[model samples]
Target: MKIHNPFRTALVATLGVGLGILMITSIQTLSTVILYIGTALFLSLGLDPVVTMLERRGLPRWAAVLITILAVLSIFAAVVLIVLPVLIEQISELVDQITPLVQNGEQTIESLKGWMTETFPNLAVDDVFAYVTDWMAKEDWQNNVAGWTETIGQGVLVIGGAVLAGLFGAFIVLVLTIYLTASTPSLKRSAYQLVPASKRERFIDIADQITDSVGHYVMGQVSLGVINGILSAIFLSIINAPFTAVLAVIAFFFSLIPLVGTLTGSTIIVLACLLPGVGSPATALAAAIYYLIYMQVEAYFLAPRIMSRAVSVPGAVVVIAALSGGALLGLLGALIAIPVAASILIIYRQVLIPRMDQR
Candidate 1:
């Protein structure tokens, strides 16, 4: 052990550093592809339970996997087809409405100034509005606001090369998901071969539990999102809300974030009703009432039933995991955070706790 040469040790350390640098650079360069691969893997794990259920119900594994993929794609297609047209129309309508909205805002500000002048004669609050009104009335201000408003996040929606690249990335993810899901058994077999012989059976059991937990969590989240979207769509349509489909689609994404997401999803709808001076203030009030009732229904009834089958994490842990993951990796990070926390808890309980008890 003491026969190490200084030159040899130095060369090895230098090579290790060089290799690490190379790996980091390569990962950065191919980050997009890597992200797609990770997404596909996540989807595969999430959907694996459904595939297994189908297999247990007498369908062949391949047939089960195919059916699951088809079901997923069908849902995706339906969302796109149903929501895309409405979203486009809503964007156009929103742009057209902006000028009137701005004008209404100016009127509201003037009205507020008048009210302040009457009620608070001693206060200089009215002067604040006067100064703001003068600044907002400038031609440059109007054009600048209007110019950005007209564009309306249009760059991302445009059918350009950038959009096509996004489509390509999606296609890759979709293909990988299907392939990986179908080959799950093979992957498991190969993975088991890598485990130490004595622990292989135990490892498989733990792995299965983890995978099942992941699957349950994913399905539960998706179920919650779909329910939120459908309910939102129905309510918005019933109320004749401005962008029913667009808001519903938005709800679907927001609902994927746990707990606070419902509030956020509904807040956007409420703000659209209230802030867009084109609409009645009552619409916003109605939105707030509806969401309050719905949040209660979700917390006491829906979430309990839906999330029960998934690995349970403490409420405090859930919030911390979501925040930490979100800070690190944005939406995807937040989405996976709870399940990851659950897995850690599982390992601690089954592995660490037992070992500690024995000691």
Candidate 2:
């Protein structure tokens, strides 16, 4: 391995560095594509268990894959068809209510003043209200509204572009997921062929365990989200919360993220319960209390049962993994972090620990 010519060695080293930089640049440019592939692979792994269950029930692999895909698509379609209209209507209503307040500063301030006075009868708010009213009166409400209108127009354009891009990305991921799920066994065989024959069995074992763990974790997380969504809808309806359907949808999606999702969703739900016309302090308080209790029940009771089959990552490791992953790759990273951590722990325990012991 000794180099005879120093210049030749230097030239080779420089070329290697340049090639690495080129590769890095290429990867950075293709990061979005990579993200889509990773998401597809993750979802395919999650679908593996369902496909396996169908196979066990005497269905052919193709049939299993077809059924799984159909089931998922049906669920998604049902949600869009049943929930989207109601969600849009509620959002429109909210916008309508907010528009008048923004348009009429005087009315908004007067309403705020009245609320403050009624909520805190002992506090003298006359001077504060007068100052606020005078300051608001000095500003040009028409000009402000014009500015807001312009901003909203620009925002709508941006949102429309983003939505188009998102839809395209989703379609790509969906196709990739279906392909990956269908060809998973063949793909695994091809990959295993690349490994040294002597070590292939061990590799397969570890790979299967990791994939199984990932599938279980995804299923468990989805179960938790569904439970949260259903219960949230019922409870919010009982309390006459504004936009209950929207809030429940929010709860479901947020609950898919680990650790902080429930807390973040709960905070939003409570705030929504305090909105004007449809909410009161009592309603907010009630929502807050319910969430606090629900969090405890989820942590102690539901999560354990649902997630029993998934690898048990340590709490500290889960926290660190989630934060680091989120910092690195945003939401996708956070979603995959715990399972990745579990996989790493598996390797450490099975390989590293044994090697160290041999030493």
Candidate 3:
């Protein structure tokens, strides 16, 4: 005959609730730290293929890691050095050309008004202009700004803090990536040791395949981005497009997105081409045509060759993963989405389906 202690149970429940609350609070507070750690781990995985390639060529592990890091950093440095000055100069040139661009816009507007007046004698351009002007006056954005000064000030502070945090996060990720990359073998061994002896071999094999896929995905995406940027620069320069360097850089980053990246990037470039001082509708049309042809080439030829080593995710899976990830974590989510889908798919095919079949 045992008596249940009500007081003791209540106290235990209280303690458990308190502990859960503490854990939630602690996790919220350390969100940024977790973000950095995850970034570092992903970067290490992404860089592993390069490291392994060098290692296979008889380079020591340390030497392989160092070479891989150096090559990546060197290319980044070169891009910054070449693109920065050109970007700045292009920006300044845009600023300098703005007055002309505005004048050209006004002239076009005037010509359109004249044509409309000639075509429709009763059409009142003055009334239309007055209505637009009145609508603009009604908005009074200055009053909104005045009312939200404190909110705006807080926003500015938040932006500044975010920028500082970004820099710190980058540093943390770099250090962690270097350490993890160099120590991966030992880390894997230690991690595997935690698994049951019977399952360890299977776990290792699956993990190896998944990580290899991750590495291949990263390399393939990077190669495609470089190709996209270079091609954009060539085409934009040929058309004498304004802000070619900046547009190319934009294309480079946008090309990281799967499926629709090239189309999105091309749209942006075409719009820039349609700018008053930049390019005309004819040039924009030509640019669109060029990208259409390029997109087919990339899809049918370039992607297959570059991504041969990576596990293929279906188009629907790629799209859903990218959208879901982007909705959750923006760039990082989108960047990792495909690889995540690939990993899940690998598990499904190798583990889940086989087990189901066995059952």
Candidate 4:
């Protein structure tokens, strides 16, 4: 279509541009609000399955929700009261152990090289070790590392302000989560009312499946984290590994993130087991071997069983979805990616494929 009047066309174009700019500015301003709401909604969905299970056991919806919320609060309180002190103490000890290494880069590098050589005599690491040593010797790399370490150490002091802000934000999220969880059914009804009557039934079916998938996935992931934490705690305690509680806590939280979390946590745990005065090569080797086996079991056994029930996504698709999601929005994106992908797969299988076949 050609514009009949240039002045009117230009005016409309300018208005459109202004509107677009306004939208971008508004979104930027409300980014934190958006994050809080999204996180709360995600958590509410995760809590839904537990609420439903309680309701199935003959409790009213409100009662079920109350019980579930109370249980969650209890868990949170326990972590804060019982675990936080131990975690803090162990972390302080860990920092103390790391202080010497941070101050002396050459010694740290040499120690690391010696450990690697001792741990795996057959591994060809001499050339790589020489290169690293040479690099560290040149360009005052030691000071640079020390500077970075100092910056990180100083960051702990500034975290008080961020912690206060985070607490306020967390309270908001908790309140939102409670409301969302309690009103989920009504919310679904309200949403369904907006759909055309002809399509509403199908929409409800698909929507329910998607929500169920998300809820189940959350539960499964949490279960995996719990398992990892408990097992790590037991194994570490058995082997007399330093900071068993702290390491287990790390394992738990990190395992909450999808695919890469377990491996990342495992690496940290292994490294922690190799701390200069506190840890030995034997302990680090044992931790490494245990994690290697655990990863295999989780991938081939545990994950397949738990995740298969939620979404029958292909392994390749799962990896790609997680990577893409993580790239786009970090942790939250990665957590949401699988269920979102599952929802898409459901639509493809139940809706699009049928329509295509008809065509």
Best prediction by TM-score: 2
Q: Model 4, which residues run further than 4 Å from truth?
A: 100-138, 141-158
For each candidate in turn, the TM-score is 0.85, 0.91, 0.87, 0.87
lDDT pick, better of 2 and 3: 2
lDDT (Cα atoms) of all candidates against the true structure = 0.84, 0.92, 0.87, 0.90
lDDT (Cα) of model 2: 0.92
Kindly indicate the candidate among 3 and 4 with the higher lDDT.
4
Model 3: per-residue lDDT, tens digit, 1-359?
56499899889999999999999999999987887887777789889988988898999999999988888789889989999999999999888877665578678677657766765689998788778769867987557767688899999999999999888888888899999999988998998899999999999999999989998998899899999999999988898777999889988898888887778888998888876546676788888898899899999999999999999999999989999989977888888889989999999999999999999
Model 3 ranges off by over 4 Å: 1-3, 99-134, 141-161
Clashing pairs in 3: none
Best of the two (1, 2) by TM-score: 2
RMSD of each: 4.2, 3.0, 3.9, 3.1
Backbone clash count, each prediction separately? 0, 0, 0, 0
Prediction 3 TM-score vs. true: 0.87
Instruction: Assess the local accuracy of residue 176 in candidate 4 as a C-alpha lDDT between 0 and 100.
Output: 99
Which candidate achieves the best lDDT against the true structure? 2
**Residue 12 in model 4: lDDT:** 96
For residue 105, model 1's alpha carbon misses the true position, in angstroms, by 9.7
